[model samples]
Target chain A: MTSQTMRRRFAATTNDLLDTDPRVALTLADIGVGSFNGRNHPDRIINVGIREQLLIGATAGLALAGLRPIAHTYAPFLIERPFEQIKLDLSHQDLGAVLVSIGGSFDAAAEGRTHQAPGDVALMATLPDWTIHVPGHPDEVEAMLRRAATSDDRVYMRLAADTNTSPHPATGELAKIRTGTARGATAVAVGPMLDRVLAATEHLDINVLYAATVRPFDAATLREIAQAPEVILVEPYLEGTSAAEVSHALEDRPHRLLSIGVPNTEHRRYGTRRHHAAAHGLDVGGLRTRIEEFLR
Target chain B: MALTTAPPAVHEYEELGRLMSLMTGDEKHSAAATSTLDVIWALYDQVLRIDPTRLDDPARDRFLLSKGHGPMAYYAVLAAKGFIDLDTLTSFATYESPLGHHPDSNLVPGVEIASGSLGHGLPIAVGLAIGLRARGNPARVYVLLGDGELDEGSNHEAIAVAGRRHLDNLTAIVLDNQSASRGWPGGIQGRFSVEGWAARRVNGRNHEALTQALTTPHDGRPLAVVASTEAGQ
Candidate 1:
């Protein structure tokens, strides 16, 4: 629980949700890898080869017809190209379909920049009715999907890198993670890159708050946890999309919010998200070092 | 299917225009913009059998506007057929108005789907035709598509799918204004000339051509009647 090791928990939960809930359907926008097995389900799982717009629209159609549709695709195509569809067909209607997004921030490390979903968190959460949850580890992913499965609420899950650093808390809900004590100041991790933050800033009175729900924020809960005058926001995207904008928006009330993610300079760079994170010190040690200096 | 929407008795196009003028400008424009009103008048007058009072009856033939923006003409047809109050046309596109720029299936009376996007309508039309064929229900699915909307590929896919399936009960009318929005290439009939689509380009404004093509049963393949029209007509 103390270290990172939780990717499987999230996948298992999603598979279980699809298995048990008869009304739940998922459109696999041609993605077979990264957390989802794409097997086990029958014709119900629609594999639309690389058509993000149709994929999203199909999900909306299925949802309108009394199905709980979960559309999971690469983050960039999911929110960027088909943005008009998202804003109109899905988000505007508030169809209550769960948008299970994978590859937040630098998660698309090997695929390079076009694949890195640096602006998604910023773009999506700003919409009228969205609930964003960025879990720090795998256990949180499981718990988040569980909660999402039960509600008719339209949710956008910013997924973590499926292979690395899993966080499983004994008391497993997102609310529990946010309410947990900070080992130092609360370092808010927004993407699947939470383990990097934990590994980096261990010396500071470090307690990790894994807030994953993007919209329909538990504002009271956020305000309560982010009470510290010094708060740092971490996500895998750039300035507009990651936690920085969120930090600034919350600036009106209180809290000293510092935003961190892929810097503007590194946007066009080559490498995987993990490499970029490590290069820019998004990893645990890099984050740990920054906190020590910032607090000092 | 109970046919209730009887065409108003022998009203001249001039009289029909006068009946339409009773509504406000936006409503009239909305009605005017779809296809030439004559096509709609012919459908209600000579062909389709349905009670205007029972607009939502599933047994009735389904008329879908794949050219969703063409509601300009469609609204007047509904009014002329008495499917909706002629006065309700005045509230077109206002807040909460059922007559929006694009049809909202939920709000608009007799609308089958929410559409304004170019490629969306045909699929729903295909669904309707398929459903009726499957259920052994005799309802015909009529879809009006604009030529410019072929800029969207999905409409093409729908045409291909329908033809392959031999859905004799389904009819698709392509409004070949050849214009995308206010400007752009305005000759869809010109574009289709390249494929050498064994097509019939008629004066979209001409009532007889529109009606005969619309009402006549196809021996094989779905019908694509490309009618040329001026913008803002």
Candidate 2:
């Protein structure tokens, strides 16, 4: 299957939805949807012209005025730059909006450090009552955006250039990809990390699980599937974003965990996504080497 | 629409102080609330077409208190206009009361947006104007800001966008108490004028001046009124 960018699917799905639903509105910070501007409902599709803070604030206001607003922009500009607006305007005011962001982790590695947002999920996790979705494929992006647009809850859908080989249709909970014997190690992969994770553990005896939605982390399912004392968590964004939840899920039993993802240190090196992935030990070979070392 | 309860029998504006006195318990922002007392009163009493009966009406005017740090004046005005019961005034800031230091849209009867942190209200107001316009509703959107709050860059973003979009249904009231660390060189009204908004300056404490300035017609652009008053009055 040919890989597709999640940003393209997001624009298509949102544009289609805007045609039928008058309640649905789109706010942009001059990031996505350059071509769809002419066909889109001029009033519904608001381009705030590079103002990230107003992007969120206006979305909150649209929600306040009884409209469902989907605010889109790059990850760093959407989450980090206008964080206070997200906290006070939307969350504090009890307003609902669908915040869809692109350029996850190091997808914008070529654009330099300013464009990358490895901490988007971790930062959004700080706010209460947010539904965070890290979709791994274009199909998943379409499904998640449709779901979030129909609901009144505050949602943050993180999309990226990195994608799994095929879409995993299962959502809301963890999907068990391979079940191993009890008392062995279990590997949990989040979003786009599934492809590399599957390759890394292809010949191993450990169980593997894939998750598209990370927030409201499925501890119940983890508790049921994680029979072994050793668990490996591989995320696409910041390392150990869900470590506390994993520990809490297994509080009754003493277990060990190995978290693999982008490290905390800034690489500061300009390169491709693959170069950054390899540098952070997130590639298939690096992941396999680390997982094998941990199992031994 | 008329007020839910009978209009207060006695001096209406004078009763604001009495309502404000009901919630006193070592509040730090009593002075801050006093600074916005007259403007809030004038807006609720004369200019705004909102009441408890029309709280959910799409065409009803929206009044957002952007300068939300001191909201005693806001609570008093809501009580005076009968959007909220006068009985709820004494419960302000209590653990169980809906009336907190900063206004919450969900908890309060007629608040359009929750605001306390500076510079959020104006942008939200701009968005509301756009949303209302898209819905083809003629309701006007109004937001009140503190002079010091302009130090936040978010307000500038809203000011520029609203002016550029020609949001004629929106009005921003800046209660300039001369409180910013570095005050605007040409005065706050000039800041709005430079951004293509219809700008005006008035004595914040004078009801007639506030009404006249706020009601001034700005046909094809957003309006900004810098109501000057003493800080901590």
Q: RMSD in angstroms, all models?
A: 6.0, 2.3
Q: Candidate 1: which stretches are off by over 4 Å?
A: A1-22, A33-43, A93-96, A135-153, A162-184, A240-253, B1-16, B19-66, B78-84, B93-100, B105-107, B112-143, B153-172, B180-233
**Which ranges in model 2 have alpha carbons more than 4 Å from their true place?**
A1-3, B1-11
Error of 2 at A147 (Å): 1.1
How many residue pairs of model 1 clash at the backbone? Answer: 50
Q: What is the TM-score of each candidate against the true structure?
A: 0.73, 0.95
A56-92 per-residue lDDT for model 2 (tens digits): 9999888877889999989999999999999999998
Model 2 local distance difference test score: 0.88
The most accurate candidate by lDDT is 2
- Quote the TM-score that chain A achieves in each candidate: 0.79, 0.97
DockQ for candidate 2: 0.79
Winning candidate number (TM-score): 2
